[model samples]
Target: YEEPLTGEQYRKLELGPAPIDFDNTIQSLETQSKIVKLEVHYHGHPQERFISLDEPDVSLLSARQLEVINETLERLSSMNATQISAFSHQDMPWKATEDKEIIDYELVFYRDPLTSVREYE
Candidate 1:
């Protein structure tokens, strides 16, 4: 085997700060952010249910509609995940009804069948 290079040889091989590949990073983040895994559930109504919408379907939704879902999720995301189900009324706004407790947290946005306008609820 050949002997190792000297310190001076190694210094010569050192290059200045490398150029940042922002394009790759930005592209990666954009691609990853587009794929959101959402778990949906519904309650209060007599027939509780879960919704399963594919990625393509979700992408068809308007930005505003998605914002509402994101904002709602963000609010809950900041809370203690472990004690989420344990939260009482004191931790939230005044209850408008006794069925306010959330049994499902899946978020789905779609346009009204007739109006064709995006609705958050």
Candidate 2:
């Protein structure tokens, strides 16, 4: 996708690229009762799970945007956190960025074949 789903800037963290405002955004959503955060142990490790209390307002997104979101979720749903991080680390946007620096969204256009979303003719 040429355009990002949101305007949030993602930072190149040690694990991978992550949204800088993720924690604050999650806290706000939880406070608003839009979602619930649960602490759960998975494979002897503690993990945070979010359960949505209400359906999303799909009216806010275009059909193409929704399709991209769904496709991305479907592709990633099978992976565990570690696997997802590893997968993200291989992308050019994450690899090219300096540690703790904001990753440029335009780097998506230069992604390697394995991590590329678009097919070239």
Candidate 3:
């Protein structure tokens, strides 16, 4: 089995506060009258977590981050895994683990998207 869960993971298992910059963007988007189409948050199993930051401002995804997120999404799009498993599931080419468990999903905004969210002002 994977290494035991770290104390930090056991501590809260909650979606920690987003990066300061991301917080600013979220605020800005909310202020601009942009409606949030989808706002979902989730936690991964032992070592991973993510957040789905979907909105009109989604265009703000950076190239690298976009690639990673989209790739996982693409794989998920092709499967019938649970909401949590689909996104954080790491099985590929060949199966690895038999136990299927939900993992934490943490969205990181430290990296800016290739495109910027259009400012409304």
Candidate 4:
């Protein structure tokens, strides 16, 4: 038995942030031009894949920075899970904490994105 409200198996726990109560308005992280750097910024649950951008976002980084990013991306893109997964930033087969075996996903970039951010209201 647990405190507060108890359940036999799983309790409807409010583990993370409360749902946003929107009223005739919406907020998004959309960008028009391009993005210099992008990352997976998430808390509570890692579900940032739900955000959709129509087209690719361009990169506005300098030559050296761009080269580094491009080089890293190229190497990483050509990689397969069986090859390596040391540089992963999120949950993956190499970083799994559950009683799992392997990750059932591909780790590669298909193309060069034109953009990576967007906003809505």
Q: Write the per-residue lDDT of candidate 4 for residues 1-121, one digit (tens) a residue.
A: 0111111122111221112322111233333322222445455443333334444343444455555557657766775533333334232322332222322222112111322111224
Alpha-carbon deviation at 108 in model 4, angstroms: 23
Per-residue C-alpha lDDT of model 2 across residues 1-121, encoded as one tens digit per residue: 7788887999999888889999999999999999998999999999989999999899999988888788888888999989999999999999999999999999999998778766567
Best by TM-score: 2
C-alpha-based local distance difference test score of model 4: 0.31
TM-score of each: 0.27, 0.92, 0.26, 0.26
TM-score of 4: 0.26
By how many angstroms RMSD does model 2 differ from the true structure?
1.4
- Candidate 2, number of clashes: 0
- Model 2 misplaced regions, further than 4 Å: 119-121
Backbone clashes in model 1, listed as residue pairs: 39-106, 40-106
1-121, model 3: which lDDT tens digit per residue?
Answer: 1122121221111231123244456567666645343434435433322333544354665565566556656645664335434333322201221232222222221212322222225
Give the residue spans of candidate 1 off by over 4 A. Answer: 1-56, 81-83, 86-94, 99-121
Q: What are the per-residue Cα lDDT tens digits for candidate 1 across 23-91?
A: 454456456674333444434333322233334556655666566557656656765523443332222
Candidate models: Cα lDDT each: 0.34, 0.90, 0.35, 0.31
TM-score of 3: 0.26
